[model samples]
Target chain A: MSILVIAEHDNAELKGATLNTIAAAKAVGGDIDVLVAGSGCGAVAEAAAKVEGVSKVLVADNAAYEHQLAENVAKLVGDLGKNYSHIMAPATTTGKNMLPRAAALLDVQPISDIIAVESPDTFKRPIYAGNVIATVQSSDAIKVASVRTTAFDPVAAEGGSAAVETVDIVDDAAVSKFVGEELAESDRPELTAARVVISGGRGMQNGENFEMLNKVADKLGAAVGASRAAVDAGFVPNDMQVGQTGKIVAPDLYIAVGISGAIQHLAGMKDSKVIVAINKDEEAPIFSVADYGLVADLFDAVPELEAKL
Target chain B: MKVLVAVKRVVDYNVKVRPKADGSDVDIANVKMSINPFCEIAVEEAVRLKEKGVVSEIVAVSMGPKQCQEQIRTALALGADRGIQVETDAELQPLAVAKCLKAIVEKEEPQLVILGKQSIDGDNNQTGQMLAALTGMGQGTFASEVNVEEGSVKVTREIDGGLQTVELQLPAVVTTDLRLNEPRYASLPNIMKAKKKPLDVTNPDELGVDIAPRTKTLKVEPPAERQAGIKVGDVAELVEKLKNEAKVI
Candidate 1:
């Protein structure tokens, strides 16, 4: 059996999460071939070939794919569905958008966000916001899924000369939409892929106070995150929210400052490898789960933490 | 254009969820349930669209226990014109839920469908896209902004690198992101008005779909706890800890 990993990236550079997706594919113990589907993604295909445990990289470049339109992507992956035992991508907004469409078109159950591979065909994943873990065995002709990149280690570049094949592009005008552009904060680490994260809460008072968290994050080389209260109050964008309504992050080191631990906030970060809570309220719920708790005001604690780090 | 919004009831976001003694799932006893926040946003977006004269009707739908009626009523109170509850006691995998919703879409024949990108309880953001596929319609997931024009809709979406805006034909599925719109709370006056709104409760059997669970939970456990690390006093000292002790940098 062979595994097909759909490499996700902009036309310019590959994302590190693709490496972790490759790791999940590798765990299935199959020859891994990656598909880079987008316009002018030859560079990404070349990059994919250099990753360890990958045997081949296939590039399907066309203007129809500039946006990775879910319609066109499903058409392409569905066309290639007959050739592999498994088709996977990193579970991101993009992967989540397209893979299920492909899976539904294929009439298969998508093993969403597999945390582990018990075998080439059986996998483990979380359900109900990490409330339950289930081992799934796929009896479908082909298994398809999106990998939660946090669960696996990114394979280092082995610098190989693997073959790059250009596949026939599928043109489907069903996706007649174009996203004008996005106002992305280029300085921040992609929250989904960051290894270490520091998030703030409403206790910081307002948007400007996040500067302290940002400084400490920069020092630690961590991603800056925010609580739902902060996001709801307009301190930051909702994408930065760490809660039930936001992204689920499991970083190596998570430092939360000025945040009372709402169950929603704790739902998002409870899986971190190390947790440190800095809050003035000794009775804050965050202290119960925090390995290290500081009952000090963030106004005093943040700059000191930044200075000490 | 007509619109459909899907909602789900979950354990209140405030409750500290513990695993059942049998370790099958999170214990949900005594939890105050509410409309999934994102779904409320979706319903709000649709209702706002309706008020703007771009949309004609806002149909709210939910797939859960009979108790989901409260959530449906909540949607109506928030401004939905009507509600459809697909009665099912089974634990729904995203795929099965999509199937049921797709059946409703077939019957309602609305021009637009909206739902939260994912239900917080399941964290499976697949239903809308899956339903779109099952119904052979286009989809815009994680939409921060939505606008409807004659025969088509424009959406601004959140992606990893940045945002991207796309347009889709009507009879489309749009999932709400956190920034899509600020949902309005139901006023006491509106709450009274909603009591008179039409809510038709139906079974998954009536929807012509099986509610059998596609996936089963084997165990539920709190994630392993993290080890405590050092906290330093200043930047240079922290740098010392990183470069010398922890060596992560």
Candidate 2:
């Protein structure tokens, strides 16, 4: 049986989540292949071919594939669906957007954000926002699933390389016309790719108060994040939100700032390698699960810590 | 312009989840159900469009059992002009839902179709994109902002790195993001008025569409619990432990 993994990247650097997804796909039944669809993503496909267990890299290079629009990708992938036993992607926004459509086109069930893969056809995923796990089994010939990257470690690329094939498919994606793109400007790490993430909450007070978080976050090359509370309070944009309804993160270090660890928020970063909480109210629920708790005015402590870093 | 907004019924966002013995689904029998949060955003966006005079009729559509009627009523209460229920007890796959919706679009011909980025229940953000594909229309997923201009709609989409805005021609599909708009609760007057709104009930068979569920549930269970890690006392100690012990810093 052959497995197809959809690559997550910008035609240059690959997200670590893709490697984690690769690891998960490898553990499951099948010979592995990675599909990189973009305009002139040769470098990306080459890099992906080196990932451990990947037997081949399929490249679909065309201007129409540039957007990664779910409609077009789903159609193309689904059209090629007959060749693979299972098609999987990371449970990031893009994967979540594309997989279901492809599954639908294949006239099969598509499992989302799978947390555990037992056999080739059986998988476990979260329902009710990480509260309960649901095990899904596909009797269909080709099973489609989105892998939760947090559940697996990123695989290192082995020395062997794989062949790259160009896929020719008509672009059925008539979605939105091309428009302007404004990238989030930041000096620190990107949230998903960051090794460390420091997230603040409503307890931070106002926008200016986030300076306290930036200090500590900068020292560690960490990305600054905000709880839904902080984002709702207009302390930051929604892009910075880290919670169950927000972004699921697995950073090496997750520092929660002035945040009570609500279950919703914890659901997002609970898989982090290490989590630290700094809050004045020691009784705040964040302390219960925090690996480290600091009960002090973040105002004083953050600056002090910044100077040391 | 006529609009169609898709919604899903799910466990209330605040409800804590527990898995059933069979591991096929969550123990949802006792939990309160509400409109999926993202679908709520889609409803809010459509309502705003109506308020802007960009939309004339707002038709809410959902595919599921008779129980999903409550979600339709909830949408009606939130200012949707009407509701359409495609009766089916099966968990319709995204592609099937898209096919069913394509049938609806062919029949209703709504100028715009709005949906949540993904259902909180399935967390599959595929229906809208798939619908666009099945119907051969434009698509904009995970929209944070949507502007209805002359003949085209401009949508700002949320991405991992940042945001990207695109423009689409009419008869398009747009899925909502968390930042799109805050959903408004139906006022008492509107809730009372919703009782008089038109709610058409039809079976999926009537739509002449095959919406057979393609995937089956083997079981449902709680995730493996993580052993509580140790908690250090102070900031200095915490930093030291992180650097020296966890070795993550």
Candidate 3:
């Protein structure tokens, strides 16, 4: 079978989630083609060609696709996706916005956020906020699915050489216009891609007190995150939240501090290889999932932890 | 301008769901159900638009069993003018629900349609965008802020990286996010008044839309449990365990 894996990029570099998606496509046992749809994204297309499992890369460079708007990109995907057996993308915000529209255009039901590929037609996904795992089999002619990147190990970024082809299809509905964006600027690594992640919660008390965690994170070269409570309490922006509705990370090391582990927060970080929790409440549900637990006040523990590191 | 807001009745967010003994599905037999939180935000947004004199009327719609009408009434109590219940006993996926909504959209021809970004139950996050596609309308999903102007609406979306603002022409689809606005609780008088609001019921067959499942669930199982490890006494012991035992530091 031939599969089309949509590449997620910002015209300059390919996102790591695309690599993980490629790994998922490999597990589906198909000849994979990467589609890079963006204006002046030749560099991204070239990078996609180098991914180990990709057989080919299709570059659709046009101003209409510059911002990856759903109205325009969905039309292009719908038109081209008809020829493929399966169309897949990483379950990110961009993919989530565009893929379902394309699936509806094709009159096919989209299977979202699949965590395991049981077969070409069957997959396993999390439902009810990851509390239950459901195995679903698709009966549609062409399967459209989104891969949960954290569930799949990413393929090598540099290995193979694939031919790059230009696609001259432009389908702009012109019903919507991109106004602007405010992306977070961080010197540290991206949360989902980081190897080490340190997060705080409501127990952090206030926004300014996050400096203690930040100091430890800097020493460990880890990305910093916060719980839904912390975000709602105005301790951090929504993007920093780690929960069912926010970004899911499966880092090698996940350290949660002063966070009374709610089930929603656990859903995001329980998959980490190593989990450490420091909370004064010994009965905090987060300690149940943590590999190591410390029952101590964060105010005294955080400073000592930073100094120890 | 007329506005259409869609709501869903789901398992309450606070309830801890578990798989049944037979593993057929999550056992919500006696669990308390409520309006999905994001849909409440959608209804609140529509009410605010009406309060600002931008929306002339608000129509709240839901597709499910008879019980979903309760959610629609909740929306009316929150200031919606009327309600529509697309009653069905069939298990509706995102595509089928979108088809039913598309039929309603075609008949109502409202200036704007708003829905929750994702229900807490399925967490599919697809119905609004799929409905927009089926009706050939532009969509603004995961909306944090919405402003209605002449013939257009500007939506600030909550994306993975941060926020993005997009301007869609009228008759567009917008999905609500957590930060959109705080939903006001319904007063006792408003709850009583909602019973008098007009609520019309229709079936999917009357809309001429096929509501069939495209995917079959093989099984449903609980996630693997993570066991809690030993508790450390002090910061130095925690550091030692990370470095020597777990080697994760």
TM match of model 2 to true structure: 0.94
lDDT of 3 by residue, B131-154 (tens): 999998999999999999899999
In candidate 1 the C-alpha lDDT for residue A38 amounts to 88
Which runs of model 2 end up more than 4 angstroms from their true locations?
A170-172, A307-309, B21-24, B227-232
Write the residue-wise lDDT of candidate 1 on A1-309 in tens digits.
898898888887888878999999989877899889889888888888998888988889988888789988887888787688999988887888899988888877787888898887778876555645666667677889789887898898766667999988675857457759766665767777687889999899999999998898888789998998898899987778876557778887788888898877886888776677888887888877775667788898789878776
lDDT of 2 by residue, A1-309 (tens): 889899998777667778989888987967898988888788888898888788988888887778777767778888777699999999887787777778767766677788888888888877666766777787778888888888888889666588888888766566556687777899998887789999989888999988877878877899999999998888888889997768888898898888888877887888887888888887887877777778877777667667666
lDDT of model 3, residue A124: 94
Each prediction's TM-score against the native?
A: 0.92, 0.94, 0.99
Q: Candidate 1 lDDT, tens digit per residue, B131-178?
A: 988888889899988888778889888776567888998889999998
TM-score-best of 1 and 3: 3
Predicted structure with the largest DockQ when compared to the true one: 3
How good is the docking of model 2, as DockQ?
A: 0.61
Off by over 4 Å in 1: B210-212, B227-249
Instruction: Report the number of the highest-lDDT candidate.
Output: 3
lDDT of 3 by residue, A89-169 (tens): 999999999999999999999999999999999999988889999999999999999999999999999997999999999
* Clashing residue pairs, backbone N/CA/C < 3 A, model 2: A104-B95, A175-B138, A175-B139, B23-B219, B23-B220, B24-B219, B24-B220
Alpha-carbon DockQ of candidate 3 = 0.88
